[model samples]
Target chain A: MCGIVGYLDKVGTEGGNVGSVLLGMLTALACRGPDSTGVAVFGQHRPDELIAQIKLGENGNGTEYARKIEETGKEFGGREFSQTSAYLRFVFTETNDLHAFITRVEATGDPVEVVSVGRRLEIVKQVGSPSRLEKTFGISAFQGKHGIGHTRLSTESVVDLSHSQPFWGHGYPDLAIVHNGHITNYHQLRRRYEQRGTRFYTENDSEVVAVFLVDKLQQGRGLHTAIESIVRELDGSFSCLVATDSALAFVKDAFSFKPLVFAETDDFVAVATEEVAIRNAIPGDFTVREAQAKEVRVWSR
Target chain B: MVEIDAAGRTTREVNRAIRQRIAESCKEVVLRNPGARHNLAVAILEDAHIRIAGSAGYYCGGLIDGPSIEVEGSAGWGLAESMLSGTVRVHGSAGSGAAAAVRGGTVVIHGDAAARLGVSMKGGIVIVAGNCGYMAGFMAQKGTLIVCGNAGEAFADSMYATVCYVGGEIANLGTDAVIAPIDAGEAQQLEKILSTHLPATLRSTKPAAADFKKVVAGRKLWNFDKREWRTWQEAL
Candidate 1:
């Protein structure tokens, strides 16, 4: 099992320190997933281009990383800039060989992990506790209108940095997800996506959720529509939080096997694995409520 | 009366100390600055009086036996879950699945409650002074849910032996749970039960049982009759 938290500023002026609140929410869920933690934050949006958050894996050196970035940037019509020691930011034209570009970055053999791909979404995550991650990434310095976070238990995949959660919809802009519970048909879905040449990074069932969603979004479906389809098509006990540059939303499994709570106020909307996280993230008497079985809720600024 | 501050301690530390104190001749325990932590004061089998001054997180006073617990503030999910014998009073609201699957207990809620208030309960007595959300007693086998206020959708779906009484509107009733007539004797019995467990102010202001609607299982569901089973299988 895992934990998820999603947030959106409804009033639009709350340029909240989204990373700080996300870390607090993730900290509340540390007991649920002690193995690793991840977060996806959406800041200022860019219309004509998509940004990718980068992390150099085991074999990435400055010289080789520059060469790989040069190669992928030329192919994708993009450019790269450093955000932090572990995080590099890349901007790409919307209609380039984006799929191939991601594959190139991922398949560098030594692994240049593309943590997220979106117009404003930049996911910073690793194999550590929530508090530890905050120290390493200066996540508290990130300011945004909305974001999503997760603490993963690592049930289906190896306990590695790249396998941590808040999976990015690699092919879709500004789409990321943090999920709790399992996907019963992940192997079948993985095979289907793999047959279609979709490159998968980890064996985590949650990664399949991001891939599945991007597939639907790429097929001209809206966020709400894709989530509704997911409730029907996917069979499992999952409660997931999804984030986009414009919105934050969540969907629960039909049986509601996993715990997910959300709070709504005039200024903001917050969702988490439990109300405790929501309580800590949002201040003052927001109306806290449970996500009903099979409920899909969306909120935006 | 014994008082303990839970401001700077983990749930483990608080619960361990509370349990230890209860074992060492502590009859009344007060926990201040609860910090709304999960699983606070869980699995106590003593007959002590435990009072939490601040809000509590999930499963507060869960599996409680023989204790009379009270919360001055709100509580999170599954409050008093699976308790055998206790009197739990929540002065503020409670989260979903409160008093779920209790074998024996008396839980009184002074304020509104969230969804799935008492799921799959085997036996218990639940009294809510305020409205409750959906599926208040879903799949309950045996218990009694008395709501002085409104009830949300699908109240008591598929309930086997559990009985429900609501003074206000019911959005929907689940399978096998139907509105049944409240005889004079049953109405008086519910009032007696409420009086015994409710606070003095609430007991005095209790709604008349005659004004409430009674709900119970559709007896046929209690037995897996061959005819009913065939009907169910065909539907499936």
Candidate 2:
């Protein structure tokens, strides 16, 4: 079982100590999953630049991999912009074909994991504990209004930075998902998406949720509708947390099998697989409520 | 009673300390600032009295095998979830899934509960003093859900074998869910479960407790054998 957490600072605490606070939340869940860790930070973003975080493994050559990423993103007028040890951020214009550009970039690859794509999103994940990820990726230095994180045990896939969670909803500029529990119908859904040329970066079912949600939104559906549709279409026992540029939301399968608790106050709204993450991240006396099965709630900053 | 300051410690440290202390069979440990941090005192198997001074975050006293845990204030979701045995008392409101999937134990909530109060409950006794939200006992397999106040819609939909007592109005019931009379044995059971387990303020007399309408599973519809499956379509 993995740990999933999401936070939205409603009382103007945006761009505060989200990095350290989220790190503390992830640290609280270290017991749940220590194999790999990830966080999709919603840092301040300019509207013009659509950024994507790529984890293609060093490939024995950072320059070569980085050049390959740059080359792959040639469509959408992709530009080589920033680099970190964990991810290469590619900037493109909003006018690009979000679906086709992300699809093509993913198809022509050494199996790169596009963690998240959004104007404000920056996903940092690694093959280690929460502390290791933070220290290695400088996660403590980040400041964002809202974000979602995951700590995984890797029961299905091999442990690696690429297989880490907080899978970005490819093509959707501001969408990310962190889920706990299995999507049993993953293979069935994957087959349909594969036939249509949707590239998958990991064997874990959580990634499929991210891709599915983005595709739903791409069809011009609102965020809440897309999340509600998940309970109807996705067949599994999952407690998932989603984050957009403006909202942070959660949805549980009809079984209520997975545990997800949410705490809200005028100052902030936080959720986790357990209450400790909410308390650790935003220590307060807020009452914690479990998200009901097939239930959905969205918090906006 | 021992007191812990949860101000700066992570859930790991706090839970570790709790587990370690309870393992030593500490008689009483009071947790301070028990605000919404998760997995506090989870899976404690001791019979100790672990009290929380303020509101507790998610899964407070979760998976507790045996303990006389008391929270002076409200508790976040899934309070005493999957509890094996013992008594957990929440003096204030509780979030969703208060006693969800409980196997055995006595959970008493003095305040209202959010949705799915006892979803998938297998066994045990859950008593909610105030109203409970929709789908209170969704898919309950076995056990007793006692709601003293009104229950939201679909209270016991698709239930298996759980006995539900609704003292107030029931918005609706799901398929195969129907009202049953509170027999003398079940009435005594309710009275005993509520009076003996609840605090003095929540206790009610036998006659008053008998005002509830009992809800049980429609067992005949659970599974259809080959013989019944053939004629099931026309029977409806």
Using DockQ as the measure, the top candidate is 2
Model 1 chain B poorest ten-residue lDDT run: B227-236
Distance (Å) between predicted and true CA of B199, model 2? 7.7
- Local lDDT at A28 for model 2: 81
**For all candidates listed, what's the TM-score of chain B alone?**
0.92, 0.90
Single out the weakest 10-residue window by summed lDDT for candidate 2 chain A.
A55-64
DockQ of each: 0.33, 0.33
Report the C-alpha lDDT of model 2 over A1-301, residue by residue, as the tens digit.
8999888877665557677778988998988998989998888777688877776563323555667778767656688656777467778877656666666655645655566788888888888899988777878778987888899988887887777888888767788899999899999999999998887777888889987997889799999999999999999889999998889999988767787877788787888887667766675455666666678998767
Tens digits of per-residue lDDT, candidate 1, A1-301, equal 6778887877664367788888888888888889888889988776788877777763234456756775776677677656554556778877655667767776764567777887788888877799988877878778888999988888767987778888888767678998899999999999999999988888888888999898998899988999888899888989988888888889988666677777677777888887678756555654455666678987766
For all predicted structures, in order, the TM-scores are 0.84, 0.79
Which segments of candidate 2 are over 4 A away from where they belong?
Answer: A58-61, A67-80, A90-92, A99-113, B1-29, B33-49, B54-67, B73-86, B92-105, B111-125, B130-144, B149-163, B167-177, B182-212, B217-236
